[model samples]
Target chain A: MSQSLDTRSSPGATPGEGPDATRQASPAWRRLARLALRQREVSIFLAGVLLVLYFQFSNSAFLSTDNLANLVQFSATTAIIAAGEVFVLVSGELDLSVGMVYALTPFVMFFAAGAGLPVGLAVIVGLLAAGAVGLVNGVVTTVLGLPAFVTTLGTLFLVNGLTLTISGGFPVQPTASGTFTSLFGASPLAELGWAVLLALVLQFVLNKTRWGLHTIGTGGNPVGAAEVGIKVRLIKTGNFVLCAALGGFAGVLDAFRIGSIDPLAGGNDIMFAAMAAAVIGGTLLTGGSGTVIGALLGAAVLGILKDGFTLLGVSAYTFDMILGAAILVTMAINVRLSIWRDQGEG
Target chain B: MADASTGRELLRAEHIAKNYGQVTALTDINLRIDRGEVLGLLGDNGAGKSTLMKIFTGFVKPSSGQLHFDGKPVELSSVSHARSLGIEAVYQDLALINELNVYRNMFLQREPVKGRFLGILDDKKMRAAAIEQLDRMGVRIPSVDVPVAKLSGGQRQGIAVARSVYQKARLLLLDEPTAAMGAKESALILDVIQRLKDEGEMGIIIIAHNYAQIFDVCDRVNLVEGGRIVFDKKTSETSVEELTDMVVREYREARRSVQAG
Candidate 1:
């Protein structure tokens, strides 16, 4: 890194002009390249495209309409949940119970409907229950001054146990009307449509709303936020509620699409996948930066990888191994790129 | 307008004193700033200017004192309470969230809303207002879109000052506004302060180490030493050299006392 800096700082075509002037004097293509590298989502999008091209070349059936539809549906599930996770992550907190909430929400809806509540009202009750778990997560984390990781980790196990007990350790079919199911996930395009719509709205909120702005401020500098009267605790707690609610919503859609609600569904696997998607999409783990659309693209990338690997006859175990390696490689690249960007800016 | 000439008090502190356990931070401080007046507080480090300012901004409470704002005796509970009563401060740290953009920082807690049900932020309006204010203050920057962390220190300070000015509070407390600035940046801020003084609407209390800057922008200057106001004089009556000599004498006396001890 020192050697690279030495070379970068060495006299170029314009001597003693300072970094800003030299940056401006650089060739247009070099400037464009720098801009592209600076926007992490753009690079991630390009990587996704490259991956698609590689898969399509390896197997002609990779781009088949039926396969593409399946890819969209699968990616949409991760994307919706990940979008919500971005809010919590950007607000400098974590919600490990999201996956458990996903598993538990469907059962809550099933039981509520079984108790003779209207199916629509049951779904609302389920989302509200998920939100309640988040509220607990928030209250415990903030009011009790516990780290979000510990609070949510405790909730994760408790929620999982609750799901198991309530479902009597059995899978149950949902009692939703055909119209409701179709609107949510039963139709081929429904989940993807919902994902796209949610992503757009969430992106707008993150960029152009007071809540989004405050969340960023809270994560960026909690002391500063509080000093400026940004309601740091309320912003963080609200994000927790939103994150769990979105996770529950995504679970309901997935359950309807799959035709059953299982206690085992959307355990650690989906949670990890969604988190990976968020990271790959350029939301910083350390907080204060996020992108919802990037998450959608990341989910798409993961979906493509899964579909392509299966088509190429890779085993599930091998897929997991490959996914782990991919995450490490991507993270390493992200760190390196950030270092370069910082150097350039500094 | 008549208060401008009569020095009608905007905020008054009578016999204010503060102590941190056994250590006294302020002692029998009597300070007042009138409408349309700029009061410069000059002191070495730990001389209680900041503590007094914090008391005025409600970040700290005086152990024994009465604060009167606009002739109303009130107890200030918190920083927010002070702000709600139209007292705003630009502290030395500036309290800016580095990840947010300039416009967002400018409109941090008081963002303009335009949509239904927890209305969305009006970014375009904020952006335009921030730019216009910065331009008016002669604080130049490339754009309001980039994160504040990317800006230079002087630029960040400029944004902080501009934010307070745009808030248009009744009283503004600026702590070492030009402390970290260069000649050019300091000039820009001094110019803004001069403009505010010319407007003659808000009361400003500035803390500064630079005697020249205080004389350049302040109507009256107060010298703080050993947790007390040692000297108070109108700018026309006191020279920068006199203030510098007074501070130097205090430093010499303190050194002699330490050696004797």
Candidate 2:
């Protein structure tokens, strides 16, 4: 028995010095490289850096202050929505109605303000309306035992129709002004600040809370999570609510930044981009694990490509082809990298 | 090292029976385990060993039964209810989230929280505690930071057992602790079980197929057949040959009845 224990320590010996005397004599730099490859967010962050360099080399205007700010602001919307999408994806669910909710929120706020409510209160009403859609999505998906994809798909159309009805299918200037608009999204870099802050906070929540741990466990193995007394339904429902609310908030921010709330804004286009950012950020499409910071970096990559392409006189129509190819390649790389890591360790 | 000594009664099942609609999974089971004792449950496939274990772990409720814990009558309404009373089971599946790190899985639903913050998990503290517990049990691993999916079968089983022990479970139920394991791995598990028995702090009920292993670590054995315990005896009073013969006779009778029907 003692002999078995003595031999068992050799298989999983790490590089750094430890109590296990049977540790393998691997070089420090090699181990460091292995660690970087093991962490998905680290690899994606590197990829984002590479994309920045590629864009800067292709188009000098890509690094200008004006273009840089524009890049951050444009990607801010995708980053915020992707951050929320991480929680839902990690909890083994999907929120397809986020794009529709994004288009619907500002309209809801505009209608509320027109009805004699204060702009601040109207914004709250907008958020509440957004949260209500999320609640309906959560309840219908969980309580009725419907798949979240189907449930959110139904709400997506419903919300799109509602936004069109409320806005009379026309783009309208937002009534919000002063501190409300500035704090929300009107000022330079305001949306960027919100995006970064929300990503950091959500990343901390994912790493340092029971809520995050349970979320991972629920998605990784629902039966195991339930066996350990975790309320799987509640965790999943909460994630759905979070994803939709973030989607709605992003929509409101976009409206404030662009100075207009269009009924047709943020349809399936933005929805697919946010989803792509999450997947490119190393979040598994099948769920179980994700990273918020990775999602932000992923959004940065997309933003760089879009802005860089426009500066280089590349047509807008070509961007979609690149986006589709990027998604496929990123996912394939993620799978292949993980398999290699496993083989190296084993 | 086996001796004749009476320990405090820890758990008792009285008239326990379970039925899945018209299918009788378990019928009229009466059993008891004492603190500092290792009781082995021997059974063929579909003979109600797992059903009985599920009832004990609060995963399944018997149609008719009364469970007595610590000499007091109690009702286990859920897995958490059983765990709150210090009754934990290491199931056949191990009930582990493979994507989670070893420390996280060890603290699964009951994560240690930082005192300053309301809902923040203290990963450092959990890692330290996991190291301590695994060290105490002589279960060696590379690190607590690695995910359980990256571990061997024996190491994963060790983590499950170590988690149950770390939670201070007074009654530990192990379902097939050594199934599918190689000889070396089984020896390691049996060694841990023997060490736990020597510590004399927990009442353990182990379900195993190997008679040799049962004799090696268990103080008593119960042979479950047709959803009922047909043979109950002290391990010291029986031989592997005797138990094997009994099972063979029962199998022959079952086969004859099947042919006739």
Candidate 3:
């Protein structure tokens, strides 16, 4: 860094001299390489492409439309949950109870169905139940001044236990009509489109809405945000609620697809995937930066990895190793961009 | 406009004092800023200018004081409440979120909304307004799209001033705006201060140690010594040398008294 500064301050360049006279009159290819390095999202996208190509090369069945659609369906729930988690992550907080909420919401809807309520009403109640859990998480973390990790971790086990006690550790099939099934996860359209649509809307909200802008500001500088009259606590708590609601929505959708709501359907594995997807999408674990489309692409990368491994007859344990390596390499690029950003360069 | 000649009061702080447990931070701080005037508050490291400013800005409640704004005595509930009453503070840190873009930081909490439900931000309007404010401040930058982290120290200060200005604040409290900048950077900020001073409607209180800068942008100056106002004079009436001489003499007398005691 010191050497670069010294070079930048060197006295070789002069006024009225053309661009060629500058010290940075290196090859165009070198400049192009720097540009590629700076565009972290493009690099991540290309990596995803290469992964897809590798899978295609490995098995001809990998690129089949039927198989691709199946892969999207498999990745849909994780991707959806990840899209919401991006909000919480960008706000510099974590929501560990999302997986537990995921399990609880569907059971809530199932209980509603058993009570002879309409399926639509049951789903709304389930989503609201998830939102309530999110509210508790938010209040405990922000209002009570507890750390988000500790608060959500406590709720994670508490919610899971509540779900187990309520459901008596049993799986109950949910009644669903054609419209409801097609809208959530059972039909062909819902399976692939829900994740993509949610990702698009969430990305729009994060980038183009006042709520999104405030969320970023609140996460980026809580003190500054408060100084500017932003209700930082409200934004953070709202983000937690939104994230949990999305998680519940994913679980409900999955329940409709599977035709049964299990007490132990979404566990630690689901939470881990959702968080990994958010990170893979380039949402900073350190907060103050995030991307919704990045989360979708990250889900795609993971989906491809899993489907490819399954087809190649690779064990699930090796799957974690390769996935971890891929995430490390992509995240290295993200860290580089962040470091340059901190150096006050555009 | 209020008559500056007759000493019209835009804000008046009467007998403000702050005590933190056993430590008396500030006592006997009586100050007032007239409309369309710049009041330079000169103080050393612990002379309590900041404490007074914080009290005035509602960040810290005075132990005993009465603040009358526009002739109304009101207790400010919080910093936001003070801001609602048109009191804004620009800290040396600028209090900008470095992770957000220039336009985003400019509109941090006060975003323009257009959508019916949930009020989506009118980003187009915000971007144009940010550009206009920066242009008015003479803050040249590549674009308002980059995060504030990409800006220089001087540019950040200009943006901070611009943010307060755009908020239409009545009394701006600037804490060391030109503290850590190069000659050219400081001159640029000085230009901005001069611009604001020329607005002739808002009151500004600048806390700084730079004597030359105090004379350059301020119409009136106050010397704060030992948590109290030692001298107050208009710029046209007092020279920088007089203020510096008084400060030197006061320091010597204090040292002698301490040694004798």
Candidate 4:
């Protein structure tokens, strides 16, 4: 252990300088750099790079501007959802209703638009409907002290039932009006503009705000955070609400992208995909540590794999099996990298 | 040893009692901690050491008791209330997020922010402050940027100690700070405790099962048994053997009573 500590020490100390003196005099900058790279994220990032290169090699189409644009567009939808899931995960909670919430958002927007509601009002109402579901989820979880998984699972069914009951179990199509379609799902900039913008904003909030710190703290150690005067319950409740809103927003984006709202827009498969993206990006299911950028990268990796496989004419049925395998492998690699990093530090 | 005559008492607990459902967890516990003194709370598992500390830190409201902080009667209704009054508890778990680096963990919930509205976390200021705080505590690590999950148990504990000190915690409650540490690492932690004592009149309540450690750094030792204080004596006035005997005797008596019932 002493030998390892010595090896890990900063390079400025003279060769014969005593260990105690070396420890006492080491510079702070060197230490900070060491801390930044000594985690699973760095390793996962490297793996993501390797995957990108391998896919690019296998298919000449992989690196084309058009494919890259499509890849970003595809990832934008899932990345937005995952960004919110990051909050829920960081608060040591989960929202299984996100998938159902995603399915219900478009219907709310469609009905609002059909009622002659202004686009802005319709958007607000749609967001509010999602926020309300999130609020209920948060209240039930925090006030009643129920585990987030069970509460959100119940909400999943509840939201799904509501969507079915409202839509009469049928798909809802928007008027295809230029303004309505453009705001909801139009790609005027020739890419997923709103989706990308939302992802970036969420990323900024996660990385730069007080809410981000509290979310991380709540997930990392609830008891410790509480002792430090952090309102763990409040942070967690806020995360659930935020996550629901994001999921709902993603649903709106999806509806606009497709120009229609299916009763099963984002079914269980998308939830699995989002989870895979998050976990593969280094967000542990156990919570306390995650990054929006990592999730975005993870989503990109998945998007590339799926798109590439489909472009190569791989069967859709086989894609599921491939995705399942990919998720398992990525998660296994992430776990191993974390363990290795931990061992290296000690 | 310095004279105990100068500093004022910072915390006092009177007839503190707590019950969990039907079972009594702690009973009639009385203790006093003066500024700049380290008081060791010693007991084996299930000896109500944790319960006493919990009550002091407001994790569990005492069914009945009076807790006085800074000579004022205070009701610690929540952990935040206790912390706002300069009380901070460092549990054995260290409660650090493995994914966050030292500065982030140190300033976790109470991050220093800049600006009027949507004040951003002052990362530069926080990082500098975390370095200063840990350095003052005599803790040397590779970096503050690495996630704490990568740190050794000793390093992690050091971060926790640094956090409490950074918060200007007047009364620090450490629950087995060095329980799983090696001899060298444990000694390093003891050095931190000594530094804290000299730097400020920060009263500390250290809960530990290790008698040697407790005896080495503590000014006084309080032995708890069967949810009550069985012996409270100055460390210099008491021998380790006597302390061991008191613990063993309490254990046997408690076991006998349980068997008899």
Candidate 5:
């Protein structure tokens, strides 16, 4: 880094003046490449890729087309949920109710479908129920001036209780509607469900929209955002709504993919893993800086790691411990890197 | 026509008073700012300078008295109301989002949208306008895309100034704009204030503790003690030594009164 800086600052470095000028002109591209390489998401992605390569060399079944497809299929739900978590995390807030909301969504759909409602409308209604819960959580946090963690925690338990009561502690197996089940549960096309499509669209919106910019700004500096007339409250509210809506959609996808709606379908472990993926991907808990792509990459890394560990004959309990430790170590490294970067710039 | 001859007072605060429960923050404060003049508000710490400025910027409401804008009595309910009437403030912190690039920060609240349908932020136009405004003020930043956090302190201040001016602020209130700045940056800011004065169409109220700065940039200086205007004099008619004496005298008298009570 020091060498590059020195070269950029050397004499006769003016654009179009000398050989150094050519290098100076390419600084923007070089800087972009450096940024991509330095991104925490990229590092996690490389780790996932390396893990996959190692597993494939060790076990022939690991690289089989069927296993690879199954891996992607398994990761799809986690990726969708983590994508939603990214918005909440970036806005300097958290949603603990997401796991409960995820569990409740499938129940809502199954009941709606049983009550003579069409599969599509039932799914929509289920999503709306999740969104409504999210809205309640957001209003509770913002209007009541409660900490998001506390507010969402209350909602988490409330939703979980409601789901258990509705299901009567029993799993419901809906007669899979041919079109709906095929769209979200089948082989090749299942990979392209509403959850995955929504994730892609959300990633785009988070990067390319005015709303995204304001969310980042509000998280980074709410006071500054308010002073500049960015309407921090509105931005935060929108982020909450987006997160809830996505979490609800992920819940619907889970119902279709799993072919059954269980009371404990989306347990605490799913929420924990989603959050871990987001943090490991580079979304700081303190907020202000993060990317949706980073969350997806983090999800991919975790999924690959889990799959690779299983292939390598690692015990399930040991794998869980290792995953938890890896998340902690990655988070610590991220913080150290951020501090070093800030100090170097200063 | 008569109002035009009188230059139509832009801002007037009459008998303004503020209190925080049992504590009196300001008392019987009366002031007026006219178009194209710099009103230097000078006060020591705890002298209600910040209180008055907050009321002016609609950050706080006075417990008593009325604020009038453009010769009409009005209540500024929020900062947006103040901004809509061309009142812009540059607080001590500058209130700029440091993570954003210069163009985005400058037009944060008022970004120009482009295209006919599905309009997106007109980055090209905003960048051009930002560069033009900064260049006009002799501010030279390396790139408009650089986040403000990476910029120098002086450069950040310059961006704040540029933002206020770009918004076509008619009444600019700068609260200790030079307090934390070095001599050169402060001088640059002072030059910008002077240039705004030369434009002769906007009113400026600068709050500063430094007598030298007030003297250098202000047309008239209003000295406040105990939330009341103890002295208001033309900068040309007053000496720095006399202003210092008045401030010291005001402080001592307040202290003596407290001691007596």
Candidate 6:
């Protein structure tokens, strides 16, 4: 009975029969290019490459294996946090507390270490502490129906203050140099490889799993998602927790890698950079869609740009100006691509 | 003849009333649909039609109501619970994620899972099934992989309807399915509704202002006014002219009262 219409109509008529015929007839190459442009990450990746090449030409040391390794190590923390930002952004939430979480977790680990806990156990506690902050952020924003930006922003300062109080406003220098630090805070290449691995797994989850699908749906249309039986609030809360947990994890990894924990190391600056990386990578702050791998490329762009400027004797102030310009140019291109897609097919 | 469809109650709502703080959204609403029934709910703006549908779909809690589904009294605690009982509603927005591709939007939170205790979405199965299911419903989209935002209104509506049917919804609520649709698109929805009605496993309640359109697909039509059902009649007992006359009469009376006030 359900198959009645299938037999009645021609078995295989495509959906293109109705909407704009000119678009249906557009050249395959043009369509392909438009598709590529629609993906903002591709352009961002190309921009990153161009920036790298420009630096390599400007200074021979820019592309050296050691310098490249340094770039990876420097970008890994921001990239790790960006992965979580991708989750939160795709689920239609802002996580402004990520930087403070990053700064605070290492101190949590340090205090736990001082209390005679194993490094592994301390790391776990630190991550849990970060996740707890995320839980508070999620509950306050979701359950209480508070605005996400305001809620997370308040939590950011609170976490930063807590970090200062816990570490007494001082950097907790590493007390032990052992396999624990070597394993987690390995050489730049190894840490970068691990970050990439985590990113790819998260990307798979975001693009493939039901949780990822629900997250996208929730962000795309909260009412529509709810109408379709999706747990929209739950998805948002989960993303919030995940974003904070990843931030905490990044702090732990960096502390172990650098052989010290600085309570004042990362502030709102790290959060802003991570958010910028996600945005540059094509993750819309407006939510619904983003790229995980794009975040890595984005972090690399910022990391390389900062390092290249220092190598080129450019002032620290100039770095912000260049980054701000890159964002405007990328966003302008993204808007143009969107306009093209709408005019082309819609 | 026992009139099996009319006798077998699929869903029943009694004395359903809803209050949003100081405002009353619905009051003294009694409604029901039986097996293989197509019930058309007619209402003006703010007549609480959508609110009632929301209550049915478990998106809102009624202050007081008793709902019987498939002869069992049940409280719909959540949208998922409603879905589990084979009740689904497609709103005027179509409840579609425009950014997502047709297949992904169709599956949404209910993707087909395969490996490791359903840990992974079986894309191959989902894509194949999306194509087959859409094909079965006679909805022609160029590709199942295309984003829904790119599809025509008719195609998007078809995808929404096809999704509900594919997911095994036994009681379907369609809020103004043909509101913004073109002639051909409206006909497509009517055909889908008629086909579903004929299948006898599903009962559909459609909210539409068009009396003629409702007459074309519905087995019965209920007119609501002031948050209550004012009149109800089977399609067999009501003609297009009679419905038009009654509605026009009601409109004129409403205008007179407003002018007097």
| Fnat of model 5, as a fraction | 0.43
Top lDDT prediction, candidate number:
1
Q: Residues B1-261, candidate 2, lDDT per residue (tens digit)?
A: 223432388998998999999999998899989999999999898999999999998889889989999878998998889988999999888989988999999999889798555579988899999999999998878889999998888899899999999989899999999899888888878888888899997999999877676576999999998888889998889878889899899889999999999
Estimate, for each residue in B1-261, the C-alpha lDDT of model 5 and write its tens digit: 766645557888999999999999898998988899999999888889999988988889999999989888989898888889999998878878766789988987677765544335678888999999998877778899888888877788888988998899999998887887788878777888888889888999999888786587898999877889888988899889999888778778888999999
Give candidate 3 misplaced runs (Cα > 4 Å).
A1-40, A340-346, B1-7, B71-77, B210-213, B236-242, B245-261
Interface RMSD of each: 1.2, 1.1, 1.6, 1.9, 2.0, 1.4
lDDT tens per residue, model 6, B1-261: 545644688999999999999898888899889989999999888889988998998888889979889878889998888989999878789889987999888887778886766368888888998999988877888999888989988788889999998989999999899887778888887877887888887999999887676587899999888788888899899888888888899899999999999
In Å, residue A155's CA in model 1 sits off its true spot by 1.2
TM-score of chain B of 6: 0.92
Grade the docking of candidate 5: acceptable
Clashing pairs in 6: A15-B141, A15-B142
Model 2 lDDT tens row, A131-203: 8898898899889999998999999999999988878899999866577787788775788899999999999
| Candidate chain B TM-scores, in order | 0.92, 0.93, 0.92, 0.92, 0.91, 0.92
lDDT of each: 0.86, 0.85, 0.83, 0.79, 0.78, 0.84
lDDT of 4 at B202: 94
Interface RMSD (one decimal) of model 4: 1.9
Candidates 3 and 6, the one with greater DockQ: 3
Clashing pairs in 5: none
TM per candidate: 0.90, 0.92, 0.90, 0.85, 0.89, 0.89
Q: Write the residue-wise lDDT of candidate 4 on B77-174 in tens digits.
A: 98778888989889888878775778988987778887746757889998999999899889888999877877777788889988977887999999
Q: What is the lDDT of candidate 1?
A: 0.86
- Cα RMSD (angstroms) for every candidate in the order listed: 5.1, 7.2, 6.1, 7.7, 6.2, 8.0
Question: Cα miss at A198, model 3 (Å)?
Answer: 0.6
lDDT of 6 at A45: 72
Model 6 CA deviation exceeding 4 Å by range: A1-32, B1-9, B12-32, B58-81, B116-118
Model 3's C-alpha root-mean-square deviation from the true structure amounts to 6.1
For TM-score, the strongest prediction is 2
In terms of lDDT, the poorest run of 10 residues in model 5 chain B is B112-121
